[model samples]
Target: MISDSMAEVLRLLQLDDGFDAAAEVAVRAAETLGVDGLTVSLATGGEQAELVWCTDEAAGQFEDLQFTLGEGPGPDAVRAGAMVLVPDLAQVRAGRWPALTTESGALAVCAVFCFPMAIGAIRVGVLTVVRRTVGPLTDAQIGDAQVLAHALTGRALGATVLDQDKAPLLHAVVHQATGMVSVQLDLPLPQALLRLRAHAYSSGRPLLDISRDVVARRLRLDLNGNGDGNPLPVSDKD
Candidate 1:
């Protein structure tokens, strides 16, 4: 059953050639999966991110509560590079995100699923869905969600965010470069992103191009940041 839904995602990806069209498909897919609301956020830069697309006005409220209150499952999923599932938000309000969890549960959104949106090696955002019933996702649904998550990740890599210095969001070069640094420093993914960003700034290079160099292994990350970055000519197109 869910395989058919995943196939539908691929087919929808083929038909909808742009972000807006893709958003529509995502919302429809959620409906087919029995979710009430959905929000798809594409990572922006810095300590925070931006919400790119969302289904239903309720989803906007859900996102806003997190932004305004400064904590929630959505942000956690992005930062941790993992899915954040709230099978039932109603009773689990003593810790944090009180308003959000309570309101969502009150609205009969009992189960919430979040899937990380990742590029080849970088995590950028999460695909979030809210369900009226409180229960874990079945294996088929989880598999279908994974497929949609990948689709969303690919779309985010090509997205545009005015905040990222007016550059394309989740640039491929950055992801490649981050992977390269991750291996070199033996650091976690988020930490590696910081390293790549810092190196690019010190070298006075666009983060994307430099990241490409790092990912291609043409430019190696020096564990010691003291050395002056001598820009090396990287022939490979990453």
Candidate 2:
């Protein structure tokens, strides 16, 4: 039965014409695995990432907390380039993602399973599943999640190619914003992205929203530690 369901997910992903189809796979995976919610997050640059899809509001909340706080199983999984399954979030060791544990506890999330989304050496992102009940995924559920993660990876990577000129299968606008920051701040691309992530987290805004502002010429980040609508003169070094 699980195999049949996994196969169906793959089929639907192949037929998907947009991100909606990839989202459906996450929803179906949550149903199949008996989890409460799931989310797919793709790394844009450096430690920066964007949520591609999620199964529900709960899933979005979980992903947002992680993105805001900058630590969680999702980032850990992507960094490790492997799975990070916390069957009991409350039981985790001290200082091991304390922010995630405390915040997620309030949401009634008891278990979280994360799978890295990668092809070869390139890590695209992570698929994180959440549960309210305290228990590990059964072997069969893990297998099903692996299959679903595979399909999601293809969908995410393909979405980039299908949208415009072929780019690395990640968020283009965010990348463009990162480049803008890099030039504006006279900093390396990776450092610029880290600064962007820090600003988004500190201000409690979605990284995508902040990136959009940068891309649209509505916001400019200054090396003097200001992020405002008024544009600064382009750095002489730029």
Candidate 3:
């Protein structure tokens, strides 16, 4: 399955257009890890994070809970640039992340593991896997997840392995969304991207989904941040 997944990713990179390649990797990684769901989040400077993709609604909710409340395994793993493994959310000590634990329980997530997507001093994102039952990953499962993360980082960074045109599409949608958001909020582009991330979490949707809408003019964020339908101009220059 691991080799098949790798081959599938390579094939998609070659043939598919406008697909969420990183999300595909996360889905396969989730299956290999025997987790119920998974998500990918990109971070720079170890402070702010943007959700790259999620496998399902459950995965989206897990990411949303963390981002909305501003605390969880994903953040911890990214901040530490190491794995954050919680075999059982129920057994977690209180005050570490009260809201996260409580909300995760509501989502039926019993165990979660977050692996940072990093290459040396450069940090890209995190791969978070969720299970409905509590148990630590086997050594083999951990190893598989690590391998997926390495491949995922290169794709996320738009490294040269992929064809030039296909490579930038993953990051471009996000950059375009950031520009639209900047205009909507009348804020700097950086702050706009931050708000976009916050909005995705609050809406319980994957960042890619929301960004697609923003780019397609199907969804818009007003100054008040409530969803709006009015199309806003998005510049490629942004």
What TM-score goes with each of the models?
Answer: 0.64, 0.64, 0.59
lDDT of 2 by residue, 1-238 (tens): 3578777776766677777556676677678888998888888878878987887787778888987888988888888878999998888998999888788766867888999886444567788898888899999989888767766665555432222322322567877888898898887655566556656655767667778888888877777655442323332321
State each model's CA lDDT, in order.
0.66, 0.74, 0.69
> Which parts of model 1 have CA positions greater than 4 angstroms off?
102-108, 119-121, 159-238
Judged by lDDT against the true structure, how good is candidate 3? 0.69
What's the distance in Å from true for residue 56, model 3? 1.9
Q: What would the per-residue lDDT of candidate 3 be over residues 121-194, giving only the tens digit for each residue?
A: 34678888888888998877787677667666656654434233233336668678878877877865545655
For lDDT, the strongest prediction is 2
Error of 1 at 64 (Å): 2.3
How far residue 188's Cα lies from its native spot in candidate 2, in Å, is: 14
Candidate 2: residue 138 lDDT (0-100): 92
**Global fold similarity of model 1 (TM-score):** 0.64
